[model samples]
Target: MATLSILNHDRKIFDKKYIYPVLSRRAGGLSLGINLNTNNACNWQCIYCEIPNLTRGKPESIDTKLLKEELFFWLHEITQNNFLSNHAPPDTLLKDIAFSGNGEPTAAKEFEEVINIVITAINEFKLNNLITIRLITNGSYMSDQSVQNAWSLINQTPKEVWFKIDSVDNDDIKMINQINPSLNATKKNIESCLDVSPTIIQTCVIKINGELPSKKSIDQYISFLKNYEKKLKGIHLYSLARPTEQKITTKIERLTEKELQSVADKISVLNLPISTYI
Candidate 1:
């Protein structure tokens, strides 16, 4: 007999379709998730990240062949079954294949190769242009030359990049991301990506020390966005949706749907296409 751990690293239950759960508030319906940092590695330790056993970043390689095979098998199951019906077959429906897991997918040295692998798998399933290949990234790797090149190469395949822009003030950003990259540099880097692909700024609003983002902080972030509204595809404003790993979890809370809508309304007043996800 083997000892059982509910959260075993190799105990993923989903197969043939990467990771399950096609419906999501953020990514929308049917998201085929790609977990690049299966080992739970990441550069930034966001207080809100949901991954357990989190570690630093990984420079290791992934089994691309196994990944492609798994993805195809999963898609085959969903398409062949009554995905959303009560008597639905044993397949999970998906809307898109999203590169979102424990860490930044772009941090993988073979990031470019993995993008090709996903594109090939999607085409094999005839999903081609119907489904999106979304990259949910922290935006830190965007400044790296090789990482940017990987994204550029990925442009050959149909996809979307959701860049995280949690805060505009340096101190606030440092508090959330724990990184010290210059805000001006990040804006320029994101602008660079816009030239190549449609980029959505994904922002998360949460409370700190029992308080929401200060009025000054929110104003600065909005002001920053106003300047790049023309260059951006849109804004994704979402609050916390999952339990956090920080010991101070009690200190944070998700903004109400109404509160989020208010923020969206302000952004709309700026003439920016802003969407709120609560």
Candidate 2:
């Protein structure tokens, strides 16, 4: 049977449209996810993205009314009912309500409104101290003021942003994240994220055509992160946990524990803490 476990990675644990739950390795427990990209659209076409039929576009308009309903219903189910006991493993805590779904959540036009709805639900359920409100984002739209304002309202609950920094070199970034980006713009967005909330640099290192990241790429990444050593929370270095849906799947491979640790050890030059997930 498909229940919440390390092996059961299905995103849809229920029939809801917007909200679902998952067992997150980084989160260390169950993460209630809000998937705004019901159309499965995104601004980037990352090579290691797992979303099938990935396209280059923004998300369709969000139905904030329906989203609020789903968020509240799930919060009630987890907090006031026996949903976790039945679906999740024993002793598993509700880790966070993560804005991670099929694509970049901030692409939705109603991004700020959605954050407001989430705060309302978290307040009603009184999950302020027990769980965190997490935004798993690519840091592309972190510079927008409306998005920053939305994040500022959550004073009662603990909050964190998993801002992705897959690569610092533009060439490697275009190949990995599949976007033509300026390093300056990337740094500016990350700085914006730091101003709004606690930020963690989330990186995905993947083997392409049977080779790991080049030393130059890793060096650039480490140097870029050095600038935020004091301002940021920490770093999350992970490889592909699930298979990629992009066309280059034949060349992509997961990192072994030794290889992952080696990269982590090299990144230890910066004094911040680092966590690895496979």
Candidate 3:
């Protein structure tokens, strides 16, 4: 009776501690998700985040043994025990194993161990060419050597890190992502991730107050991306699909289809593959 919903990204839908499944719009089908941050904590408090009661912090200590057991169990269910047929829509393909919890997954101390577990699953299921291993991150700790080393372990399988880059203006960044981030540091992280993994730029665009992204902001965003046009895998531009639960001062609103298309038209000048989800 556990029907998966693409719009309802509630990680706790199945009562699982570390593993869950969702019909992901981005992944295009059943995305087996690994929720490392069960505590609803994150480094950046994005105003558009759908997670309720989100706090600012790193992930707590991971129970790797339990996590491994859950991962293997879910893999078995999907591959052999008819999980998709029973829990998700009929003929749902197992698209990817995404490390996309409520918080920044790279903050977990056992991130490398989890990657090792994924390697084992890949070999066990013989899914080398069938599915992808995705790390949906905010790109904060991508420069860490340990993180890079862990993520680089699975070379043969299809992999992608959907790094979030909402905006380039610091004021816009602060308003949307709630972080006084250093663009230089972000650049370094981007470089490190590119060196280790095939990366896609995941940007969530929302109307602030009552206006769409200004032309100046769009220009700055395009300018920053011009440097990575060759190195990046692609860009994902999407407006909010779910309502925000975070209590913030700014009045956030989902961009209309026209508004989103308008933004995409401006970014299309970069000539990179862009997919927009409303």
Candidate 4:
């Protein structure tokens, strides 16, 4: 049996241009992560973000060639060597190649080109059918033409998109995400994502200063889910698993398993699939 821990998702193992390996609980095994935002920047600053020293900005220019090389090298190592069997816990396997890192991946200026490079690498490695591809995003850049084009490419593969929709209330959004994106705009972007590929709503529910989300807030979230329950794949309801880098860390608290189940129960009323990680 593999004896490696899957809970720690540190992004600096290789510290290369784009590729990093993680034992993802959600992915259920080793996941190759692509980090285009090497600058440690993102448009939104979610209070619960685990990235240390995160800044508000788009990624600096991406070196697609370097990214491709790094990806192919890692893929070869993981598959040909005893990478997983030696580094991960027993029974671990390659789960997915995920576009997730310190920031919003779609915010990279060369996102479309980046996707192409990733696809080429995946095909070269001949692991396209052996693994899943995933995009973990804030769903804020779906309106951009380049981002949409990238999504079009992703639609051609066996992939899943984990879109973040933490709260429906703009006030709560500001409090949590530190940005005031209109609720309508966010909904429209999410709908756009659903049009391009399969999407799962990923929500992180946590207590603020020891208080759970208000009933009104939960109702609004449920209502939003009801609107697209038919097209949605499911909901990933999880709590804070890592320490935050934000100054508000003291104000944040992880919800217990019981509390996460409560939230999941409410969303389950929509008759959509729900998964919890606490």
Candidate 5:
């Protein structure tokens, strides 16, 4: 078996279909990742994205049959054998089945159907009680009915949504995410998700062009969190952990551990639990 470590997450582990695994820092163990967007496409081209040749658009089509086959096969291996000990570090354990891949997974045409398929497989394999089902999304398509239906189903299980909220300032958002996303729309979408389930705010704070986000930018972000404090699970404050393939990589830099902690301190004022992954 190939050695799998959390330190290396750039390469696809399985190189097959939509299923793969990684030692997730946020998850604190081995995570089985479902990649619905095999085409390497995304609606937003985040400057710090690690996906190579990242382009604009949603996923074309998903082969649900193959996806089901791959997911069940891997689940059996992970549960029935010593797959974790053989590939990952000794302390690692299966944490969650995460929908996180090359792009926004909710953009897939079969988003709700895919979620149902995963849920069915989890039940079939009797892994529903053992692992959590998680969706790591940018929260772009959350307002869509299909996506909302999927979220409703996911809320029934031991699951969470890692909703990305890098910055609240529209200009900063455009600069970082490389798209013109409506601030109000994003907020509404987040609220919609929170209405059904608690969400973890995943923020990736980094230096762009050798400068940290301005005080105003940080203030706006804090205010945004303040509005949704009651509905949030916590904040996942992290910095860049992998090298990027985007052209803007030259302008991006990771924050130091101290800097990350300092930012966490600022957010701590909101009184939400924070997990820092610097």
Candidate 6:
């Protein structure tokens, strides 16, 4: 319930003041966020996405120089102003600069160049020690060679990745992410990521139309995770953290803490490191 409380600034639509504070249960500190979709664009129109007026991804290449400059300026300004609340952890505990917004970041044509630019800026500013790079993706673009090449470049940095694996069953995947993802292909991509860098799977634990996933459906997910438990660093399970834009949106609801814990209980049976936030 506490996660639902929007910061005063966050309540206003089209809020362009980037890099705001969110109580990231998994990141566990002041997360320096990088919202690539300042224009409200995304490749996948996920049902759970809270961003309104979503478009079919960005059409042109992102300006790497401008992106780096903007990110550096914001980070420097925020650090100087201490914009976070007093209750927040010290500066050293401030977490990574996350790549998350309205859409998939790897879709940006200059993804590799942008990542390099960001890394250079971090080092130039002498703030690399406290800063980490985090990539949040839906795994839809992993099979693309250019995307993979960009991911390889990002993997060279001190970073961790969070891949969305909302469901192992194809039907459920279509319903949740609104994209028909190939489970086998996605698993292979995830395994490749684990080979190069620290990677984790993030799943949304929610009830659809006031109905929980059947046992068979849950088992399918658990079985998929079980196969990759050896390579995965951990699992970040969270419920609906914000509202959505879809006809079936209101029918979806956040799972209770108990319900989430129960899912974790089942997941632990596979001998994997799992973290639950509801």
Best by lDDT: 3
Candidate 6's residue-wise lDDT over 1-278, tens digit each?
12212231242232333344454557766565666665677877777777777777673556556666667765665576544544343543556778776677777776777677767767776666676788888766666777667667753347888988888888787887777678778877787677656778998877888887778878998888888788788889888776776556347888889988988887777776889876
Q: State TM-scores per candidate.
A: 0.86, 0.97, 0.98, 0.96, 0.96, 0.86
Query: Per-residue lDDT tens digits of candidate 3, residues 82-112?
Result: 7888888777899999999989999999999
- Cα deviation of 52, candidate 3, in Å: 1.0
Q: Against the true structure, what is every candidate's RMSD?
A: 4.6, 1.3, 1.0, 2.0, 1.3, 3.6
Q: TM-score of model 2 relative to the true fold?
A: 0.97
lDDT of 6 at 226: 81
* Residue 79, candidate 6: C-alpha displacement in angstroms: 3.6
Using lDDT, rank the candidates from best to worst.
3, 2, 5, 4, 1, 6
Candidate 4: where are CA atoms >4 Å away?
1-4
If candidate 1 were superposed on the true structure by all CA atoms, what would the RMSD be?
4.6
Clashing pairs in 5: none
Among these predictions, the greatest TM-score belongs to 3
lDDT of 3 at 95: 97
Name model 2 segments beyond 4 Å from true: none
Candidate 4 — what's its lDDT?
Answer: 0.86
Tell me which residue pairs clash in candidate 6.
42-57
- Under the 3 Å rule for N, CA and C atoms, how many clashes does model 2 have? 0
Q: For model 3, how big is the CA root-mean-square deviation?
A: 1.0
Off by over 4 Å in 5: none
Q: Between candidates 3 and 6, which one is better according to lDDT?
A: 3
lDDT tens readout by residue for model 4, 130-236: 88889999999987767777878864458888999999988899899999869878878988888888899999998998998888999999998899999999999
